[model samples]
Target: MAQWIRGWGQRGWAAPAGVCLCLFLLLTACGQSAPTGEKCLNCHEGIEEISAAHPMESFACVTCHGGNPQATEAEAAHAGMRGGRNPSDLAVLDAACNCHNGLAETGQDHIHRVRTSLQTTYAGAIAQVAFAFGAQPDPTARYGMLAVTDDNITTATGQPALELFRPGPDDSPMLHRFADNCLFCHVGGEPLAQPYFYRSTGCAACHMVYDNDGLYKGGDPTIDPAEPGHAREHRFTTAIPFTQCNHCHNRGNYSLAQMEFLPRPDLPDDRPLTDLERRELEYYQPIAQFTLCEWKLDCIDCHTNGEVMGDGDIHSSKLEVQYNQCQTCHGTPDALPLLTTIDSVDHPAIRSANLNPNYEVRVGDTVIATTRGETFGWVLWDGQRLWLTKKVDGMVYEVPLALGTACQQKPDEQASQYCHECHAYQRTVAPLP
Candidate 1:
């Protein structure tokens, strides 16, 4: 018997290198008079292109390439004009990784953390929450607040008002959808904008736990959060699928970028809004359930510093929470100068000053001036953080404390934040030094 062999590099046969063995077996098992489909050796010979293209998948001939197996003529059976089992939707041309056995995996540059777990029994829970509050407004009050624009319907009489609003906590279908979970955040709020499609309203806006400092810190070569040993896996509130920001942002007619939300602590604009507008606004609120739509700044823009508090400096907290944005109009602590440039300024460096030797400077009924011509006052102690006083020259001054001279104390509720503790101006200095 003459031997037949083909090299691996041959183009058109999407099959394994052992194709010849399959052909030999086919020829031996089916005699020369066997049907073309049955004699896979005869009909599958030249169709090497299919096999070559899908070397792995092309090997299973009967699965797709076989029909009317006993028919001898290629035209009679193998002509694919006759039907065969077509590819299933599950097996059809989807990206390999997308169909990876039902596992929900996200690619780099995408947020995939699950943020909330809503109960399947949503309707009942929502009704209960609304009824418990018993703070529902009257239906007339709600409709009275509606503007022609709210309904998107134009009236013959210059935007006729509609009777839409009703009393009851989150009784509307819209509010119910919102309370069930936070779907509105990514859908609108800070949707991906031009150039970069990263949503300004999505989890990426605030809880972006994928960055260097976010999930990793300082250069430590052995670090690899993706792997098991590197660090704790970063958990987030929610994750977006498809990993493409452009899909939502760049699409034309994508005006429904995010829901405009009601005002909250950080954002104080939503108040004074009519009850009707407040309901519509919740869908567009920022991550903190606040509004930052036109402002163009996210949570990270202001909260760039991190603090270590809670026994051993291990727990994470904001190092500073100054709303310096307000200080442009208000005043900052005299010790801390205002950052003139909002964008390019480097954050001021702060070090824990040692407060030892427990010293005190007193100002009696009448203030006194020091030999250096510095004026003295109540000798404000910043709770072991710093010693502050006003100089006669009319300038506020800060003095470093001696080591072990002071102890750290928890800031009061109102002064818990570095910015709050320092910026609320109570006194004006006489003159600058």
Candidate 2:
């Protein structure tokens, strides 16, 4: 026994049950893990680059859409994909903002301004509805769909913060109905499943255009034709047309008393509308009075980026930020419109113009500016006449400046409603059945 002990040592106890189980699981997972042999394009055939600027040759889809790009099958590959086939949705906006940092110093925060914009937050609408329904004491904006904050204050009307609104037990009954119906119109909110209401949420709601049909009309053969919620193409555009805006606005009227949305009775469902017919309907309501130029210019041509999108602040109402007026182009009958020169390559207007395909803003160009110094990049002053290049079609119009014209408008009192008293167009609408 003494000689055997000297020759060999005794063995220790076996591993614990947990350790043994972990080892087995590790080996099994290694064997059963998803295959990484194929790439995203192997299955998603016929898919083109998102746009001319974002060619797939350089920019990878995985960069914006988080997905298992190495996976061979659908579920595993699309498991973490942002916005579920929509990379630009607010749900996945953090990833989308990464691509928008190349414009300028302020450009890095472009998405922040949009996130806080009245369109996304719908703070003004919420405030109005809340006040009308007695959910709040006054019409001041106190809440939004999601809570948002602005660290930087740019304007006097910008709200520093907004609280997330939810229906409480003590809330008025009408708020419930409003919460159900009215919330669908915001930029990030999912549009109702209706013909004219079909649009992607967030930035895609505009940039990624959708036709009335809401079906895939792109070159991607893999996309299902039966699906009814895809963009018209896998592309982005800044030269947005009035039709794009029509998908959200001018679709219908909402009754606060009834708490219901009534589709436009004038809108014919059976057939498409002619260009003039569509323009007449889209300009405003049937009873609305507006000038001819209101229809001639697309919504984006007049509404500045800060006006349409938020300017890093939450507003109480759309009118609070809607400063664009008739005299922005037409003079005050006393002086020429506000003029400024583009002198820097890195100007915000240059970056803004570059996003679109229609026109360019170059150095030494004299363009009109707002009273507050924001440049109107499209309008050019040649010291004689102002020429405006249309964002939608690139057609130039010789803007008649009121240097010597008989326009007796008080320069400060030149809002659209005021001008309508003089130049309100009377066009015939399609007769109702």
Candidate 3:
């Protein structure tokens, strides 16, 4: 009988619980027996059963959620399945929300204080100091800037020639041309060089924002609180704050020196400031000579005059209001105008004057000229005088009528002597023949 049972176990037949052969024999006789791993799954489909249960859906019974379908002894089966624990015991699991969600309620204070740190996962790439061109080091703040051209008329003569944008279509009430904002100086085409030391022209790309609350009236600002991460306040100051400005301005990721590693014509000739130097520095430090040394005020302080100044106590027009700000100290003690001009004088025998040949000329106007680097057109000769004025668009004009004769002819010193002999005439007859 034992040999027959061994043959049965060796074949595909199910194995009885071998601990007590007598009990197995009696159970088999009573038509009750145990099934092995393969025999039970043949009818039950254990894989499908295990998958239907959500708690154990992630693993098979043998993987972790342990059980012994093949065993008959209760104690041995429980020990094998649960490492000596009862097989029917329920396991405690960790909370899903705790591991994968937003910050906890207790951590809210720390999160809100650092607005930059509170940036959501989707706030675009992290911003570096150099990355944000024209971005202020302080928390979101701003100022406006302007450039204007006006028709500076002479009250003495009602001359209509005082036009800012002349030789063009006259469209507006005033004769003037103007542009404002950082682009005026930062952009190309103007004679002024672009500032590499300062912010780039692409400031609007990242900084552009809109306020959904269109003009809030009588609302408590503290209760509404500028709608987190938005710029609602209109006023800003150049006065640097202690930790406020240093958060983004001092050494580290947002250091000014790091942003200005490249060659910049606008930067001062000094390297990184020492601790002593930084301590000595003023809050709204004045720029040096090439960068307007005396002007402690910034661009917006002078430009945003009527809108923000005196209206809401906004200090926008501090510079414009005090036009005497600069002149008050620099001008004459008697309050005379800071600037003075010299009027035109008349001199007839002036030789080297009226050199453009426009004022004084003769019938046979043969003028000998020497070649300079890129010299062009005829030099003005009054027959008796050799005239000189800066050339613009291939034409040169004498700035003052009398003193055109004395300007030094650099490359040609002999130009003065040569004109005295060959070309000489009276101022009354110069004309285009």
Candidate 4:
């Protein structure tokens, strides 16, 4: 200022040491400090609550991760580490979400709709293995109703298109047996094992969670190269919990009802087992019946991140990305439609149920919140009955909405699938002897 201290005092430097080196390089380029004193918060200062919405005093761990924040040494500050610690790696999520301008922004681009999800392009298991190998006549082959441009695959009735359906070597042998046995659960695939089934692929396979008892370990530095006491938790969240959507909705044979689990074997080698034989050795064992809001809600408590991340619609199933059912939170006997309109009250579901200290915000009520925020009201009576309460177990309940009585055998007008077809339950039962 003053012509940059008179051109640094005519290049000789000494107008009070070039105005204290131009006020310490303008306060280290306005980020106040750490010009290269190598600060990944000096060994991750309690991981600032895991990217608490991106703030290392304004996104500093080398700006969405590129190494050498001036290299104070973890191998030269992780030497050029671009997306090594999974910056939601779809080959590094367009350069680690180039700060929101490139995840694609329609209803805020959940990693480009989980990178074009149909459970990450299994596209109905590659259109039912290309219609059982006749290379597609029907299994309704849908890459969300295809229209590829280069290498030209086309079909919304302009037919004749297949684009050598995936898994190379000139594809098809049932798409290389559905990409060598049904391509590992998408995103970027591979990475699912216990330790509450670790996940990581684009968007940290549902907003990250990795630990080894540092409980909720955020700022993941990835030490679980096979459990070096598992670390990874820079806590990105959406209040996701349903045990992180049961690590892929409770696995196998299209799980959560086609249900299958085996585990019970290892104890015989020495017979030392007993904590009720290792808690009756792991068994999910079920074949059907599963709703009581899947044991009282938390699949994002009725799936809304614009119905499981994609309001920019490219859905081809998970039942077209499930837009809530059972009358979207139990409302149909007749008149209950007020999902917030009393001045919308700063609606993020009514300001998270008005900061729920056991919610109360009444104004001709119609609440439902939950995903662990828990709100519930629903009231209405005589416009034709409906009743619930549950602001954290204040439990009022009585929403059975009439089925032909006599233990409701079949009239079903979808009142939460007729109260889950006589209320579902089974985690383990059968000891009445």
| Best of the candidates, TM-score | 2
Q: Alpha-carbon error at 174 in model 1, in Å?
A: 7.5
Best model number under lDDT: 2
lDDT of 4 by residue, 273-309 (tens): 5543322322233454555444443455445554555
For residues 156-273, could you state the per-residue lDDT of candidate 2 as single tens digits? 8878898997878888888888888778888888887766668888778888888777888877877887788777888888878887888888788788887888878776445477
Cα TM-score per model: 0.19, 0.87, 0.16, 0.28
Lowest lDDT 10-mer window, candidate 3? 114-123
Candidate 1: regions farther than 4 A off? 1-114, 117-183, 186-421, 424-433
TM-score sort, best first: 2, 4, 1, 3
Determine which window of 10 residues in candidate 2 has minimal summed lDDT. Answer: 1-10
Off by over 4 Å in 3: 1-263, 266-270, 274-325, 328-331, 336-433
lDDT of 1 by residue, 270-379 (tens): 24765334323322223212222111222222221221000111110111112223222112333221212112111111000001111122212122222222222212
Give the local distance difference test score of model 2.
0.73
Per-residue C-alpha lDDT of model 3 across residues 258-375, encoded as one tens digit per residue: 3221222222224466533333332222221211211222222122122111111112122312232221111122322122111121211111122222222222332322121111
